[model samples]
Target: MEVDELDFLASSTLYRRKDFLETDEAAKSHPNRNYYYRKNADVDRLIEACTTKLKNNNDNTRALFIRASSYVKKGQLEEAIADYSKLLLVTPDDIDALYQRGTTYEKVGNVDSAIADFTTVLQLNPNHVKAAYARGACQNLKGDFIEAIEDYTVALERDSQRSVSSPKFHARKKDLQSAQAYGGNTSGVPQDAAKDNLGTVERGMSGLSLERQDSMLGQAGSSAAELRDSNGHFAAGSSAAEPRDITGTSASAPGASDPQGAEFYHARGFAHRKRNDYRAAIQDYTRAIELDPKHFKALFNRGFSHDKIGEYELAIKDYTQSLEVDPRNGYAFYNRGITHDRKGDYHKAVDDFSRAIEIDPKNADFYHNRGFSHRKKGNFSLAVSDYTTAIQLNPSHCRAYYNRAFSYDRMQKYHEAVADYTKALEIEPDNATAFHNRGSLYERIGRLQEALSDFGKAIELDPRSALSFNARGLLLERLGRIDEAASDFNRALSLEPNSATFLRNRGLCHRNRGSYQEAVRDFGQVLAQSPKDFATLSNRGYAHRKLGNYSEAIHDYGMAINLSPDSVRLYNNRGYCHAKLGRYADAIGDYSKVLELDPNNIHAHHNRGISSDKMGEFERAIKDFTAVLKLDPYNANAYFNRGSAYDSLGDFDKAILDYTRALDLDMAQGGDGSSQNAKQM
Candidate 1:
């Protein structure tokens, strides 16, 4: 059959639009008005024409191939496979038929079958780069990383020998690197190829042209005329030279003259980046830039890879270069903003994000990241505004809601913070960090029950999170559930044994429960890690005092007082330890310092009175006791101490009056009205 005969058959049988519309009322009503209907109609017509041709000549390979291609376009994978199988049976070694069938199998997720077909194609044509690339993709999908790497390497070697580069060559190298990076597994690959760490922005591997070409018969640059022989009939034994575009149009095939293009290097770099091999990716991206300094995708992707490896300055430079080429590239601006944020340059981050927003105002991630920069800069109000805009753009943006809640909390808008957290949880209920943060906010606002529930939920969702355990422990301790608090703190410590915060918290709980030795041990551990910690020193001092280790208590208190010289509580605590250790002069001096720092300190006045009386300073003891009484008129201990001082001074009348008053006050306080002195510090 001549090509004219086939063309006549196609023209007559295919696209019988007027005849079909006249017979079919639905077709008439639609009349090519809808794009979907028009497309389906064309495919249906092509299938009908191909079927008629096959009915006349059952072994017509061209008819079968055309029908199979139509079926693929219509998304009828089983039918397409059937047609390709029939075509291959007619011509057992048809490379096009086998490759198409393999692709169809892959589309239907019959990976093993697809691999078998591609393997056969490789056997028939050892230099078939597309077959090698296709098989590698299938193997990669099946988690056969070693096999995938081998196939990709084979494809790369073949392309290198050809001296003419295709994008697939770079893609093959990329897939090889990715396979090696995974080391026979498929973890760390982006679930969505278009998105990277920035979540909503297109980043790594997005620039690679890797879509399957289902509509074309031969290779790229092979026109319909080229597919025919000199007699204008289909050339059944023709081999494809390269992969084609799916739009049935020919793109200029890469020539040997331009084998190492910027795009090729960029593609290879993207693959390396996908595997987190940032150094290798940076090298490839740099080579691409050197080849074509104005290559925008190469520049942008190099920036992304640089940012990944913490080369913020280089990343910024690359992003700036990309922007110079295409100032409207929102992804470049957004990624540069992220790099700036990582470098602690929030002002620059905010500026970059604003530029990204100006280019692509509807991008929620742009607003979201800008909000993060604002929050980092302590602009809580601005952060909230940006987050709100992000939420408005994408209602299901859980991070935006969570971040907005954080800004609200920083602004002290407790109610708004809680509401945003609730909204974020509604969108993503299993977000453990959100739950933990919300629990903290609840605790801060005195909603103890809600706080406990959220903390528990956070722990339940993420049992490995030491933060969740610590937060719950703090809340439980506040609620007086000391045993439960201890359990949580222990768990937190198990997760992070060196956490001084956790140790301090547990120590405080132990102290409250009168586990003085345990409290001392925990506080000591905290001090071992942070020797200059004043709070831990004071806490250890109190624990030692409770354990009757007066010397150790005095040492801790002295260290704490040195760290915080104006701390009245530390001075008073040290003075109490001094009195316990029979160092009356030191105790009096510490108490005097406390009085100087805080004149109305009742403990200091009363304790100083005892210390003075112990040292036989009767008049000075009376003055300190009187000071305590002035500060608190109903102080029975103060009155009794004053009586002792007066008795020592030989003022018998005043001593009797003061003693009588002390007994009356003690009686009123429901204490035994015995003529005993107040308990010593």
Candidate 2:
């Protein structure tokens, strides 16, 4: 573990240095090498005791800070970070803590944090070669060549003893080559020169530290000088740059068609598809098909490209071609299934998805998409089974959990929905849509705190996500945080700008917050987008009624009825507005329309009876209220209205009996007994 032996662990990473330094320091100070071979549990216990002491004493956060270094050496990064994080909190400026944590951060893909930590360490010790090199390496991978070169230069200037040039310069050269390639220019060297430099280029990456893009150098970066457009065309000026195909280029086909040439056409087509030139890409794929009629990749890609451009018929043609050539192509079947799903052909979609799943049982998306098709067909149990299989194959499949949660919600399995959504949100913390969905599920189950927490997290992750903002606004409004609710609604509106749903939802938020003018403005926007939307019209009418704009409220109700004549709710709403305006006949007429749509509706019957009595039709009112009492015998208002109607008909005894019944119903509702008449009525 001395500086000489450190090379074993110092291949590319410096995060393990803390452990190396710790071992060397321990051997130097204690003059014993045997302690380094102690039991792991014993080491852990000692580290814990030291951590406790550090916490209790507010002690030196830097002293023996590399104690967790052995754990790190063994590749236990979680433990290392736990110890480092504890130490960092205690001593924000600890040099070893910053250095060790920076490396660990890079290892865990926290490159930004790693860069910050390394930079801080460099501030403390400007001559820190490893930190400087690591930070520069990260900047290079993140595509900041200027910053990387500056840091690399600084590291070289600070320490001439160490050579950052050998391995690092190769990476720099590759970067330059890559930039040149993307600009439609290549090295233009002899093939031998490129081939010679290729070895150095590939070798240098293995010696450099890569944080986020771990596999970048091997296959991905090796093609830096290669450039092609989406249409499978070579870069603008590099069309003729490739070497001519020799007879030995690929396996020679005895037929007139060239196999490699056919493959090139297909691959080029795929590239074209990536560039979003579906038409040209499809042409290339078709060319491949013409060269080799059984080229499945060409057929599959042509189908996929056609589907992407909404040419479902053409997509189907290519998929059929692929199936004819290679019937067992699960990818082709999966794509064909997607086409069917898009075309609203659920039966064909299910068949294709099922075939794909059968051919490749391990494909998680196949099961997930098939499950969706089942759900669309209302086969809830089948949907659940497929989603469960998908989750089993990919335990972290967030979409499967979310979709399964929907099935559970539809089946009224509220607890199951909550559990599935919980798993989904855990898998993807930044999924604002999932957070909003889970928040709704939580609200259903009356777990308000947990619901609000999810909504808050969703909003934090995506302030511009309008749905998250709207959902959080509703929760706030329910919690009596009216001002906050209004603010969230405003944020939703600002993000969406002109979505009718957002405007309508914000109007409700404004209405609840007593911001009547703002509520009206939001409702106006909704009306502008969807003038005949009855729900928005009726809801806005209610808002108008709240503001004492009786005439405006009546007008809105009238417009709502005009848009949807059969909506019983709209008729009932309009009747209320009419009743408020002393238009008894109009009110009765609307309530009757509600009754005509729903003959057994108790509310309509009762309301119409009241409106009839107001119009001096006591006999008709009595008949309607009597019908309401027959349907709902415990209705207090129905009993009261019937009693008044009987009294209006000069039937004193019947009126008294009805009044007694109304009082009894009220008494039962209140869990108390007063006068029999008052209690029943």
Query: TM-score per candidate, in order?
Result: 0.74, 0.50
Cα-lDDT of candidate 2: 0.63
Tens-digit lDDT track for model 2 on 239-313? 001110011001011111112346545534544554557797788678878877876666766776777678988
Question: Which predicted model would earn the best lDDT?
Answer: 1
Tell me the deviation in Å of residue 464 in model 1: 2.1
User: Highest TM-score among the candidates is held by which one?
Assistant: 1
Off by over 4 Å in 2: 1-260, 562-681
> Each candidate: how many clashes?
0, 12
Provide the lowest-lDDT 10-residue window in model 1: 241-250
